[model samples]
Target: MIWNIYLIILTYFLLGGIGFYLINRKKDPLVARKSYTKFIVYFFIVNGLFFSITIEPVVFRYLAMVITGVGMVELIRLFKISGYSRKSFFATSVVIFILLALGFCFFATLNKNLILFTFLVLSIFDAFSQITGQLWGKKKILPHISPNKTLGGLVGGACVALASALLLRKLLGVSPVSLLFLSAGIILFAFLGDVAASYYKRKYEVKNFNDLIPGHGGFLDRFDSLIAGGAWVALYSQLADI
Candidate 1:
């Protein structure tokens, strides 16, 4: 089990390094630098998540709380920037932070393997969705909300993510039936999370949730999919007993 975790970590960095390097190649120096920064920060974020899960459940719970607290701060800032009234902000914040807290708590109780699987699916889908979208996405699916999301990108990313899930079934010890549902849940929720965040950004007239993570904008900006997708995975794990 431990070896498998290390393997996933190795694979993540290898693929991430190659992908970022290729994408940054031939780009303007400043642009490439920004891309490099994004990649570095992303690496840290991914590893931090991995560490949180691999450690004791109590540790994971505390880490999750810290993350939720930071996320709430960012959300509060967004609400203030958007001029939400105090009542509205407090109400919305309670609802959102509650859901976010529950999501993280549920996630902490998941089987380590399942947690890793959820991460794998989200990472692949998130990365490929944007890559294919940029390379071949012409028709904007949500132009007003998320201008860059396209049908081609969504389709391409889903296809690749599904394929990868199947290919990793044996390694991950996931049955085919469970893999199908899990993959679907992760992809759908991840997309919804992205769209949901984008909706707020558009409505608030903000480019990102915040500028906390440099190129990644903020915790919400980067991990919205994980929050939503992980929650689905946790609920599905309970329901399906996977």
Candidate 2:
């Protein structure tokens, strides 16, 4: 688990660097140069620390949650410096972090089977959403802000997520109904995350979140769905007894 987490963080940092370079290539030379370097350094430091600390036992999950919350606040501040309003952006980030913390606490004592299922469902769905959105998107699903998102992509992503969850459930010998419900919850919350990110970008008149990912966006960009989906899955898992 520790090595897996480390590899994931490393991959994120590498991809983020590539995205920053590509996006900065055609922008204001000075601002691009400064912002790209600063963003990469801050993102690496914060996320590296986050991933490292989060691999501890469940007792330390709260600390990881707090670290992630603080990192999110810093991200909001960066967005504010890039011309976003501190009020709404910070408020949203706080709410999201709080919800995530509460969700973690809620499932802390739940059955490991259910908890693992919830986590797997959300992770797979969130990843599927982004991959599908980027690879095959054409018609705008939410044209006002997220013009790149397509209806077809959403369907494709959702199907893939659902399928992945079912496959994992079967492989792990878990409850199929529980997996399906959890997958459904994740899909719903992932959509909410996508819209929330879109709304945030539109409110601030920004194209992408920090230009940190090639064809993707920032940490928030990739993480929005995961955060929301994870929160929802945690809550649902707590409520359901499977």
Candidate 3:
């Protein structure tokens, strides 16, 4: 598991560096440099610590959450310097941490089915959202920000997510009812997360959260869905177990 985690981090950094180079090629050199710097710092502080927390105990996890919460606040503050102020962004981050902490406290004993379902729901939605948004998106889903997003893409992504959930259920032996319901929740929340990230980027007058991935945007850009999806999964898993 440790080796797998290390590999994942290495892959993320390598991919992120490629994105930085690509976007930088078209933009002002100074802006690109700053973006890369921000990306690395943000990735290390947020994702690095996050993975560490996952491998640590509950105490360490809480500490990691606190750090992440602070990091989110700081990132928002940085954006605000450019003229964006959406209080809900920070609020949601806080709420997510709170919920996750609660789950750790209460639901750690639950069956892996609940956890697996949650992860499957999140992963399917996230993968489908990106795939669909990239391929079939047309009309702007949010014109003010994230102009590339489309209603068609959203629907397509949801359909893909549903199909993926069903497939996972068949292969992984998850309950059909649970898979269906979880997939629905995942689809809705994944959309919410994507839109929210778009709003944040637009409000800050920036394109992509940070240039950290090759063919992808930033750490936040890639993981925005995971943040919300993971939190929702943890909470839902806990509730279901109860």
| lDDT for each candidate structure | 0.77, 0.60, 0.57
The candidates, ranked best first by TM-score, are 1, 2, 3
TM-score of each: 0.85, 0.62, 0.58
Predicted candidate 1 versus true structure: per-residue lDDT over 72-182, tens digit per residue = 777778777767745564566559656856876688677776776777778878877766676677899998899889998899889878887886676457679878888
Candidate 3, residue 76: the lDDT equals 62
What stretches of model 2 exceed 4 Å from their correct place?
A: 1-67, 78-93, 104-115, 134-136, 170-175, 211-217
Candidate 3 ranges with C-alpha deviation above 4 Å: 1-74, 83-117, 170-174
**Ranking of models by lDDT:** 1, 2, 3
Pairs that clash in candidate 3: 15-213, 15-214, 16-212, 16-213, 19-213, 19-214
Give the per-residue lDDT of model 3 (tens digit) for 144-183: 7667667766777678668756755643355778777767
State in Å the error of residue 157, model 2: 1.0
Note the clash tally of each candidate: 0, 0, 6
**Residue ranges of candidate 1 with Cα displaced over 4 Å:** 1-5, 55-57, 85-97, 170-174
